[model samples]
Structures are given as C-alpha cells and as structure tokens.
Target: MAGGITDTGEPYSPYVGLVYMFNLIVGTGALTMPRAFATAGWVVSLALICFLACMSYMTTTFVIEAMAAANAHIRWKRRESERVINDSDSMSDYSDDEVIIRDRVDRSETRPILSVQPGVSPDHFDIVERVEMGQMASIFFNKVGVNMFYICIIVYLYGDLAIYAAAVPISLMEVACGNHSCSAGSSIKYNDTDSCWGPVKRKDAYRVFLTIFTLLLGPFTFFNAQKTKYLQIMTSLMRWIAFTMMIILALIRIGKGHGEGKPPVAELSGVPNLFGVCVYSFMCQHSLPSLVTPISDKKRMNGLVLADYVLILGFYSLLSFTAIFCFDNSLLKDMYTLNFTDNCDVIGVAFLRYFLGLFPVFTISTNFPIIAVTLRNNWKTLFYREGGTYPWVVDRVVFPLITLVPPIIVAFCTHDLEVLVGITGAYAGTGIQYIIPACLVYLSRKRLQPVFGEDMPNKHRSPFHHTFWVIFILAWAGSCLMFVTANIILTETKH
Candidate 1:
C-alpha cells in the first residue's frame, strides 16, 4: 500500500487521491509492459489493455461499496450496544471495560443480527473510519471465503517480492556487465555464455548480483521496514524523470524517422503475456481502502476513481506505444528502463543512460523489504490462532525465513522476468484483483441487505450493482486462469 502513510492525519484533496492511485497502479508492472506489448502486437495490446482497465475500474468500485457496507455494519453494532446499555440501568454499575468484555463474549456466542426494522436508515458512506480488506473479509465472508481471500493476497505479495528480487539484480547485471557504447541502430543480444569479466559468464554475473542483492536487503525482513518521506520524495522524483526521459526520447527517435520497430497488427500467441502484464499493472483494488480512506472530499469519489483510471490507462498506453514503436520487439528488455542504456543515439548523456539503467535498482530496492515484511506478516496472520501467541523463535526466525527464502530461491533458479511476471499476474494477481473483490462485494451486499433493510440507501454502491456484473467478473477471472494454464501446458508440451 505504498507502505504506510507518512503524512500527518490530514486528508488530501480528490486530485491528490487521483495522483496516489496513479502512482500505485503504475509501479514495476509498467516497467514490464513494453516487452508484453511488443510480444502481443500493438493493436491487440491496446484493445486488451483498455478492456482490462475497464474491468479493474469496475472492481475498484466494488471494493469501495464493500467498504461503505463495512462502515454501516460497524455503526449498526455500536448503536445496538448503546441501546442495550440504555435499556438496563443495572449495567451502569459495571465498568466500561467490563461491559465491553461482556458484550464481546456475548457477541461471540450469538449469530450476527442481520435484520434491521424497515424504515430505518443510516448514512453508510462516511469515510471517517478505516476498514482494511482483511477486516472486511472477517466481517462479511464465510470461513472458506476468508481463507481464500488471505491466500490470494499472500500469493500476490509473494509474486511482488519475486519480481522485485529478480529485477534489481537484472538491472545491475545489465549495466555492470554489458557494453554501454553501442549506438541505437545496432541490435545486439547477449548470450548467457558471454563473458561479463574474467571467467564470469553473463548468467553467472546475474546470479552473483542476485546474491549480493539478497545480502544487502534481505535482513530488513526480520525488522520492520519503512520508507521515510524523504526517501519517497526522492523515489517519486527519480520515477517521473526516468519515465519522462524515456517517453520523450522515444518520440524524438520516431520524429527523426529512425524507429526500428515493426510491430504486428495482432498476435494471439502474445495475448496471454499481455493479459498477465495488464492485470498485474492495474492492481490498486487491494490497496484501495488505504488510498481512498483519507480523502477530504469523497462526494465525487466515483468520479475521482474514474478519472484516475482514465489517466492511468492513457499513461500506460503512451508509455508502451512509444516503446513498441521505438525499439524492435525482439530487442525490448523485460525492464523498460534498460532500453535507454547503451543506446547513445536515443540518450546522448552517459550519466542519464546509467541513471535510467540503475533506476529500478534504487526504487525497487526500497520496495522489496517492505513487501517481504508485509508477506511475512500475512503468513503469520494466516496461521495465527485466536488468543494464542507465537513463540519468539517461531515469530521472529521462522516467519522471516519462510518469507525470504522461497522467492530468493525462485529468483536464483531463473531470472526470467517475463515468465515470473506472467505466471504471477496471470494466476494470483487475477484472483486478488478480480475474483476476490467480486466475491467480497457480492457477499457484503447480501449480508448488509438484512442489516440495512431493502429501503436503506448506500451512497457508495457500485455503478455495476447488478448480480450479472459479479458473475461476469468471476467468470472472466476463471476463464483467464484456464486460458493461462492451458497455454503453459501446451508450451511445455511443445518444448
């Protein structure tokens, strides 16, 4: 969730919320989009990206609606507790803490009151309280659904960590080992067997870099990791500068009529990769509560979210389109920033070239530990027992080790960013972004209807409030999973 907020408890304007959403959605996923676009063909990429953006926006609304429902439920519970206290004068003799404890024990033994009298209404869309996605799941979902939700999120976070773990090393390897003197007209591909230095192959160099990367950043998982405000400012500044430089440079080369790309009109084989990348790129649904909760003015929240989606769609289209046109598809790197390195024709300044190459190294390094710790915490939550505490060794040593080792091992085995991103986004990413939200919002509405009565109004209801929309989203997610799975199967068979 961009880590935790570093600002004072001040609410931001809607426009500021839009910017935050844009930044959140356009992280490492955007860096991998150009390669996906080049593979899938520009025309197919454009259409698919647009469709996915619409789907992502729809689910974003679902989350907001669910959040409002959660707030309404909390308000209802508090009101019920007040009524109970008022109805019994004898209860006044109990301490507040005693009454709260008694109420909690009673609540655990009782079925949730889902029925409110008709003609009663409450303001449900007030964003004063924050309800996280996990809490919402515990409130609205059945046991099976709650477990599924956590599993999906845990998987997505692991995918995030793996991508980050592989990316920085790949960037370092490219810059440290590859020649940076090549002209833009030249298309050179480095083989794994190619020597990086004395007796070191390029592939070996990548592993070494990965090892060093793990050594440098791995320990942060054992401790709480945070990005300070100054670090965030510097990261954002570098991000914008790097992105603008790439876009402008690509446009310049195109204007000079020196563009080398000849992308296809459509390519079915590349569609799966593009699907995964797009799903991964448009992932803000899970973190929407944190992003949407602190906005000062949420009167036009739907409009603001719509505007943000449009802006992000346009930004992604511009970035990828320029990239696919500027470079040949086969020559595009998994990390888009690497395209500027070693290409003097596109970027004349040597310093800027290296900066672009090393940008991910700086930005993603900040994010990796934060994500690792997040994943570790989620693991603890998943297996955590009620009222039972973990031993210090299990809590400290086991959780961090489990969180850190698997992704590192995966990164070590293969540094193929495309495959990693494709698998992660296609499966777990789809479940988290599409399927879970659909189920959560649908179940929330069903559970909330009895509590609020049919006449009670929810200000944050999704635009696509029909049952058909929920079914459509789940079916789409299921179909995408099946398609990606079958593609992997067929590809393996062919190999």
Candidate 2:
C-alpha cells in the first residue's frame, strides 16, 4: 500500500507495482515474439500464448495472495509488540509518538525508498508467511534444469539491461528486413548462411557495438531496491511506445496483402516446446514481491498485475499467429518485416527502422537500474546487513563488471540474432527467472511444517493444503523439464 514497511526500513509508493508487470511484457519479449512464431506454426503460437497467459495470471494471483498473508502476519506481530510495550513499564519514559517519529526520521535519512530489506526488529518486518497456490504456480513454469530464464534473471536482474539485451534483435530487424539480404554470396540458402557470421565483418562491427552498448544498461540495478523515481517510470513508458509501434506494424501488415502465405511460421518449429519455454519465462510470478514495495493498497490485490500477463501473452500470440500466416518457416525473415515488400514504401521502412533502433536503446537503459537493485538485494541477503554506503559501492562495481563481461564476449563471439536468442533463451532467460524459482518453491513447500504458528491461524497453519501445491510442483516441474530439452535441441540446431 501507500506506506508499507520493508526490510530496509523505508516506505514505498503504489505505482511501481505496475512497472514490474509492464516491464516483463513490454521489453524484448515483444520484439522477438513474431520471430518465435516464424519458427513455430501459427496454431502452436496461439496455443503457447494461451498457455503463457494462463500461467501468468495464476502466478500473479499466487504472489499477491501470499504477499497479503505475509503482510498480515507482520502487522499482527507489530500489534503484539505494541500491546506488550503498553502493558510494561520498560519504555514508559518515551512517548509512542516520539518513538515513531524517531523511527520515521531515521528511515528517511538512511534508506532508499525501494529497499526491501527487513528491519532488524522482527516486529517491523512484513513477513509473507505462506506462499499461495497461485504463487506456487508462478514458480512452476520457470524451474527447469538449464534455460534462458536463468541467464535473463541472473544477468538482467529485472533491470534495464535485460530490456536492452532483449531488444538487441530489434536493431537488427531493420537491417534484416530491408530488401537487401546479407548472404555470404547471393547464392547461399538462408539456412546455409549463418547470421552470426555477419558481425565479424568490419562493416557490421559498428552495429554489434551499438547493440552491446544498449545491453550495458545492467548497472541500474543499484537503485531498484531503493525507492520510486519519475525517471524510471518515464523511461519504461518510452519503450512501451515502441511496443505499441510493433502492434501498429502488425495491424498495418494485416491490412495489407501480407498475411496470405502458408501462415508464415517462425523459421524455428518447436511449437510443443513452447509449453516448456513459456513455463520457464512466464514463471515470473515470484517477482511480485519486488513489485509489492511500491503500492498504496498493501492488502488489496492489483487486478492490473494479472492483466499485464494476459496483455503480454495476447501481444505475443497476435504477433506469432500473424507471422505464421505471413511467411513459410524457412522463408521467414529473422525480423518478420522483410517478406512484406521488394518495392516497399519509404515511409513504412523509416517508421520501422526508427522505432526498431529506439527500442533497444530504451530497453538497455532501463535494465541498468534493475540489475543494480537486484545485486544490492542479493548482496544483503548474502551478507545479512542493511545495504549502506559500502554495500552500494560494492554493487556499483560488481553490477557493471557483470554487465560488461558477457556482452564483450558476445560481441567478439557472434552477432547472429538467432544464435544469441537461442543461447540467451537456453541459458540466461530460462534458469534464473523461471527454473530456479520453480525448484525453490517446490522444495520450500515440501519443507513446510503442517502447523501454523500461534501468532496467525489464518496463515501457514494447515498441512492439508500442501497436497495441492505438491501436485502443482509436479505439473510445473514436468513442464519445465520438457522446455529445457526442447530449448537445447532448438538452440543446437539453429546455431
């Protein structure tokens, strides 16, 4: 809500809650969804979209409900503490208002508004006692053996860098979609000519560098756990405009005679695999806590949270299905726009190029702050201390280093969007974001004791509910495994 306590002893705003939902959908996922459909068929793409949408909805519901339970417990503990203090003469010397004022001033001076670290006193901590069944669903889609979700979360940490990293293909889309194809020699078959090889040439090196520069937005994570800021919101909105542009382009393509071919399938064809991939990526349900830091209605669940997931899947499905009808799998251009015109109008190309270029720039810029905050929070978790000047400094150094290292390797190693997406999806995108959370939730749930503590009976008390969660864990776990294997095969073949 408007004034909820966090681990860092600061209060957060309500709007940031929506940012989490929007950011997940509006970034790189939007850009490449068409490409995904080009490989998988239209019907498969539609199915994947439905699957992801359902998972996303259930996950968001789970997270919010669990958060509600946790906050309630924290409130109850504070009440108990207040009651004890009123009965006891131990702190009779200080007035209640004075103590509260002191705490408020101390927090305002010392903590970042977005910080989620709990206060030293358990009474001040907002504890999420029992994770809900819906929340458990969030973890289910993601917990695979090894996949892109891990890489996405580990590297991007819900920051601008992730967005930028995801947007890299958008920049290339303009060039790829142009009438001019980049064949090693004009006679090469599309599959025979590897996209990764182009960046090695001196001419394309600049483009690669530019894309990586966008990816470097990884350092911004430092501020994520701190507080709400206008700049962050505005930046996110700018990229969202790019998403709207893509949607417009899709509409335009449909209006034109573009969607008539063998339902332009994504050049890749692992439709069944989408169940796993989406389960891993969409398992982003656990991320809801990081969002809860900002809202005014701490107890009231935000309907928008689930709506964001629905909207994302809806967007993905639209693009994917459309692409399927537009081009054949092998003929499907990596960017999806190339199949449209040989004598394409200048205005259409210009619009596509301009927005495509801007999407990556904004995405990378936003990723930086998200990574900084995630690293800071993870560090606190490891060190067991409030993130202060020293911790912040450490995060500053580590965040950029981590961000810079991968892209540099990526730059020198390859520039093929397909290879990059495959590797990214297989490694970063799959693991941290989806698979790990799934495993953790499954393990954690199994580890829970049946009896709820005396302090809160409505919360974690019943062992009876564990049966449902156990089933969910198995369902998601099986799905994640399928996704991991499919990702490996698709990536290997595509590479």
Candidate 3:
C-alpha cells in the first residue's frame, strides 16, 4: 500500500493525481527522516536525498512504462487466443482501426499489423486495465521470479506492519509518562524501564497499549476496510495539521533564539540508515498503479511526477532543518512526533501537546488495519493455487493470523523504529523501489519485440530509454544491498 493508503480508482484530474501522489509519498517514513537527517548531518543528507529523489522519480517512470507493457502483454495473449479460435472457424483475419505506428519490422515478419495505418494513434499500450505489481510479475517473470517478487513485497509489508505496531504504543507510552511542565529544553527524554503509573514501568505500559491497540484494530485484518472513508478523511486532515504545527513551532522556537541544535555538516557512520530512511520515504512505486491508473489525463503525468517530487524534497528539507536546529540532536526521538508531545516550551498548551502525542496514535491506527489487510491479501495470493480455494477457517483465520503475528512479535522484541525502517528499506525496499522496477521494465521491453517488433514505440516509453539506465538501477540496488549489510555487521561488531 502507498503510504498506508490505496487509491479508490475513480477518474480524477492530473492535479488531483498530484495530491494523491503527495499523500502517498509522505507518510510514517517521512516522520522518521528528520532524525536520520540530523544523525547523518544536513549537508550529506541533503545531497544524497536529492540524488535519491531523482533516481526514485526515474524508476517511477519505469513502473509506468512497465504498466503499459504489461497491458500490451495481456492484449497480445488475448489476441493469440482469438487467433487460435478464429483459425478453426473461417480464415477471417481480425482487423481493427486501433493501429500503432511502427518504425521497422523483421524482414521475414513484415505484416501490416499494425501496419502503419493512418489516422490511428498508438493506443495499444495505454493503461486502461489495472494490472497490479503481482499480476505484472506473473505476466512478465518466470515462476521463481514471481515468487521472489511476492517474497520481497511481503517482507516489506511485514516491516510496515511492525513499524506501525510499535509506533502507536510507543506514542501512548510517551504521552502517558512524559513530563508536562513548562520544560525549557527539548533534551528531556525517558528510558523504557522508567516509571509511568505506580509500579508499572513505561515498557509495560507500552505492552498494555499494544495489546489494547491490537484488539481494537486487529479484526479489520480479516475483512475488507470499506467504511474508512470518513476515518481516512479525518486522519488526513489531522496528519497535515500535526505536521504543520510541528514545523511552525520548530521555526518559532528557532526564531526566538532558543534553538539548541547544531547538527554537524556530515557523518559517514549514519549514511546507511539515512539511505534506508530516504528510500523508505520516497516509496510510492509499489502503489503507482493505484494512483496513476485513476488519473483521467496522463499526458502530463511526467510533469506531475516531477512537480510532486520537487515539492516533497522541499517539504522534507524544511521540516528536518527546523527540527535539527530547534532541538538538541541526542534528544531527538525516533518518532519525530514524540519530540513535540512534552516540549511545553515549544507547544505551551497542554491539550496541544497531548494531541501531538496522540496524533500518530490516531492517524497510524487508521493505516494499520488497511496495511494489515493488504498484507493478509498478499499472503493469500502468494499461497494461492489455480482452481483451489482455502477452507473457511483457513480463509478467515489462518491467513490473517500469519499476516498479523510476525510483525507483532517483532515489535515485542524491539520498538526501535530506526532499525526497523532502516533494515526494511535497505533490503526489501531496494528490491521494491529499484530492482523490481528495473527488471520489470527491462523484461517488458524485451517481451515487446516478439509481438510488436523492435522498433515499436510505446507512447509512454520512459525518457531514459537506453538499456544503461536499467543496468544502472540494478547495479545500484546490488551495491546498496552489499554496503548496508557491511555497515550493519561493522556496527554490530562495535556494539
């Protein structure tokens, strides 16, 4: 799911598409980016994030082009089947006016296919039907490849569920135990074993909240979430308000000469986590179909993508710069919202502080069920067999249990959001963000030559049409995986 929400598939304008993309790209991942930015230093963070934003945008276009190619593949399959059936009936050739422009064909395969007919544009590969990543994988990838795609995506979704599972309880624990006085500095923090209620430690309080949170939101995993429109609306509104309030308050504090932070220019030790956070933050490729397919006009889609990325980069820079400067670096919380909850000097009103504390609680709670259901559905799809159905208990109970249990258990083991987001994004996120798209687009282009000839131009072909871009993405993904693994090993050895 994109930013923990999927598109509704209703026809919408390009501008509307832009807003949805914006929402999809900015989620819990963005909330954690500031701390990573502060850790890695502003200078390194800014430069790397910009380069990543560009790379993410390029792969996003690759996904779009691959979607069109997937459509083409499906179309070719239907045509092949029709050709078989028609051969038995009469020698009638199937002809249509929807001809595509082709440059050249193989010497032996000079058939007017699509034979350069006039007055018809290249409408063969337009993304009308919504072929999701899984379906596209099936169409384009081998059996092993399909399973690999499912595995990568399923792992990423599990990571998402675990992050959310920990985030809400962590928020509740903070608000419940944090100091409420007019604290002058944002440096005040707490350890997990610190007392919250009498005899009840903060870690225990977190588990209590976690249990309550699971009981409340866990049921939605078994069924579809059709009635969350209003909840989503409220969540979206509150999310924007909370983010805006945090940014503004940080700016106000800095302006009042109370800014206590002085982040270093660069820190190489933090770069691995920063890479993961940024990769995670810009993760919308998996849900591109849900967002891009609904747009009524797609001619200007590349422009929309460019503009959206620009805006997001600016938003990330402003939010992170303000926070890193306004608060001491060591006191910054993994969940950035936790930083403002008890900072009475920054948010003087008690009620506002509580709201900020619980802001993630409300918004993330809405997203949890949605993501859990998505993961559950993916589980079903991965184990699914042709013409076979699961028994009632298995369908209703087993799938959901498998989906919900691992992440909750992982959360129980550790609530370190940085580590969770870092590991998830670096490995699985690399696969989803870079490797899969690169492979899909490359294979899709190769698949096209057999059916439509080599010179056929997909109207939605990416500007980076050379094989070099795809090779570059694959190489980068491989290098990233190795580097992150080595970094983790070295860090652990040191610890």
Candidate 4:
C-alpha cells in the first residue's frame, strides 16, 4: 500500500502492505547475518536476534502510534480553523449589540469541544494524512531533539549508501576472481592478493568494480530519478530467488549430514559484531511512515506488523541456523552469497553460481542511486530555511556531489561490509530504529494529551505505553553504543 496505487486511486490491500514490509526488512542485512551467526554461535545468536527483533518490533509500534497521533493532530487543527473562520464570518454580519450575544454563544458552543473534558474524543488516531518522520519530529520535538533526529537519519542513510556501494563491488570481486570449481571446500579462505583476472589482485578488482559501479549508477544522483516501481519489483524478485536458493542449498547439505560447522554455544568475542548485524538486519523504522500510511484498513495493522516481524524472525533464524550448521564457522563469507558460488557440492551449475554470486551487484546497484538521491534530498531538507532557496549550483551540483562522494570514498578505502554494517547499524541505526521512535511517541502523547484529553482513544497506541518502555529503549540504545564503541577501541588497540 505504501507505493502501490490502483488507477482508481485506491490504496492497496493489507496483504500487499505485508509483502512490502517483508521485502524492506529483509535486504543486504540478511546476507551478512549468517557470518555473524557463525561468529556469535547458534544459541547466543538465536537468543540475541530474537531479543533484538522484539525490540525493533516494539519501536515500530511506537512509530505507528506516533504517526496516528500526528494525523489526528492535523485533523483537529483543520477542523478548529474551519470553525473559527465560520464563527468570525457569522459575527461580521451582526450589529454591535447583537455581536456580543453572538460571540458569547459561539464561545459557549465551541468551549466544550476545545477544552479538555470527559467523553470528548476530539482526536481519532486514524492515519489518513501522511506525516513523515521528519515532520513528526519537528512537530513533537524541541530544537535539539529535531537536530538530533536529522543527524541520526543522515548518518544512517550515509551508512546505507556505503554498505550498498561496497556490497555490489564486493560481490563482483568475489564472483569475477574466485574459482568456480568446488575444490576449495568450506574451510578455505580467499585473500585480497588472490588473482581475479590475470595479475589483477582481488582487492584491486574490488576497486575496479567499485569505480565501474560509480560510473554507471552515480550520475543518476545528479538528475531526478523516479518511476522505479518496475525496478523495485524486479529487485524484490531477484532477492527472494537468491535468498531461497541459499537457504534450500544449506538445508540440502545439512540433511545429507555433510555440514562442516561446529559453532560454539556462546562466543562472547563475537557478540558485539552479532549485535550490530542483528540491529542492521531488523531496521525498517526509517521507512515505516511510507509503508504504513497508505493502508486501506489499519484495524489489523498491529497484527499485520506483528505477523511480518514473526515471519522475518523465523526466516532469519532459519537462514542463519542452516548457514551456521552447513558451513564451517571459520569459512563463512561476509557476504553469504559467496558461499554458494564455488561450492559445486552445493550448487553444481556454473550459471546459477555466477548469478547468485553477483546477486548483490544486481540488486544493490539498482538501490544505490535511489538511496543517493534520498541522502541528497535529506541534505537539502536539513539546511533548508523557510521562504528561502539555495543557489542553483548548491541545489544541483553540491548536494548530489557531497552525497555521492563520501560513501564512494569509504567504499574505495575499505570493502569490509561486516564492519560497515555493524558500525552503521550499531550507532546511527540504533538512534533511528530505537531512540527516535521512543522519543517521538512519548513526545506525541505529551503534546496531544492537553488538546485531545487523556480519554481520547488512540487506536494505534503501543501496548508498551508506559514511561518505562521509553526509558528502556533509550537505555538499551545507549548501552549498545557504549558496548560497540568499547569493542571497536579494544579491537583497534589489539591490532
């Protein structure tokens, strides 16, 4: 329902909404998950992933609730303005003596509706109006809060671009250079110095692919790129095919008792990376506003969201479990698709092998321009002032250039998908996914109570409506940041 629209201007069915959310939540993050699972151990990874999924789902509800509240506030203001204008017009027609009487009557009639009182349901939490997260932040947050929200989103998007930029090339490098023969087995690790084409090192091959990727897809950022509905469908189809192939192949291998994995029950050292991976994988908060706004019916929205999360949780669990059990923990590639490429025992066909290996290249390449544009637009939004405009050069050239350059530079410098995802998801992602939603909902409730009164039935209020949940989410986010920061510092020190 978010992007899909009928010719008749009708919103999509709830089932379609379910599918969109599923596609969004399951992306490149899922590919990195198997390696994280292998490192963190099956049992620990399972527990942590479940916990993180629940947390993400909780914050998702918060965002939906805030959306509903924001819509209600918009509706209330429009109605109030209409009433005021009608009253003012009617008063103008009356004489001086009669004006006093009419004004008193008007005040008496409108007082009950405006004032906080029992049984006054002024704000109905129906998401008819589409208020984006940024608008909601501006409406509900103070100046500092709004700035923090923008910063978090900008950082997350940059991270997303970097991940996409790196993923495509990394996949290409692995596919182009690595042997297609199955002789390497699950235990062998490919190094950066390995030959890709003739004397071209794999690392150099990655850079070459990165440059080509930028050249081909980067220019779209300079222009307005739109009407990507078909592209989205194609990418979604490819993603499902690629993911299903890996899962089924892993299952087939494990069923035959040929799994090389012997992952530990718990690996403390791997928990930080695993935490980052899970956080990144579960991210759908930034896009939730678009996803939730166009639903034709939202009575079952909560249930639909819950079902989606449950299914994703099960899917992630199934994929990661099968992967950790099928491949040796030491040999699991950062990009899981690479695991299927050279292993003839699992995938005998060379064409499908190359397809699976280059799957990220195919899917993520399509997404890079779109994300780059989004980042560029956000840059404009962040610096935009009311009743003012940017110079043509700054508007067209500078913004897109800034958005496109840094992530490419990051990708050029390092192709570590895992670390990129981890750092991005752990820091900026935590703020976007957890802290922002919690604050938005909490602030929305606070802002709306005086206008709508305490008894106004909000249809989309989160089950975790207590103050403690907000505190808990924020606390969890803070603790995760500290943990990840400490891990990074210590790892660098050791290196």
TM-score of each: 0.92, 0.62, 0.93, 0.94
Top TM-score prediction, candidate number: 4
Of the candidates numbered 1 and 2, which has the greater TM-score value? 1
Candidate 1, residue 362: CA error in Å? 0.6
Error of 4 at 485 (Å): 1.2
The regions of model 3 sitting more than 4 angstroms off are 1-8, 91-120, 183-187
* Candidate 2 residue lDDT tens string, 242-336: 55655565566557866444653342445534443344345455455555544555443445565566666666666666555544445554433
Q: Per-residue CA lDDT of candidate 3, range 1-495, in tens? A: 312123446798999889889988888998898899999999999999999999999999999999889877777778768866865354333233211111122344656433435556767788877778888888789999988998999999999999999999999999888887784545487888889999999999999999998899988898987535577578778889998999999999999999989999999999999999999999999988887888898887788899999999999999899989999998899999889877877888889989989998988888888889888888888888989999999999999999999999999889999889988899899999999999999999987877677766688888888999999999999999999999999999999
Cα-based RMSD of candidate 2: 10.6
For model 2, state the Cα shift of residue 242 in Å: 3.2
lDDT of 4 by residue, 1-495 (tens): 112112323478889999999999999999999989888888999999999999999999999999888887777788799988987898888898999987678677744455555665544677776777888888889988877887788899999999999998888888777777667654358899887788888999999989999999999999877637899899999999999998998899999999988989988888998898899999998887777877888888888999999999999999999988898888889999998887887888889999999899888877787888888888887887779999999998999999999999999998888899988989988998899999999999998887766755898888889989999999999999998899989999999
Ranking of all predicted structures according to lDDT, beginning with the best and ending with the worst = 3, 4, 1, 2
lDDT values for all models: 0.86, 0.47, 0.87, 0.86
lDDT of 1 by residue, 1-495 (tens): 322223325688889888878878888889999999989888899999999999999999999998888888788888789877784666678999988887788778845365544466646547567787888888888888778888888888888888999999999998988778754345467787899998999989999999999999999999998768688788888889989999999999999998988889898998998899999999988888878888988888988899989988999999999998888778889999988887777877889989999999999999898889888888888887789999999999999999999999999888778888888999999998898899888988888777655644888888999999999999999999999999989988999
The TM-score, computed over Cα atoms with residue i paired to residue i, of candidate 3 is 0.93
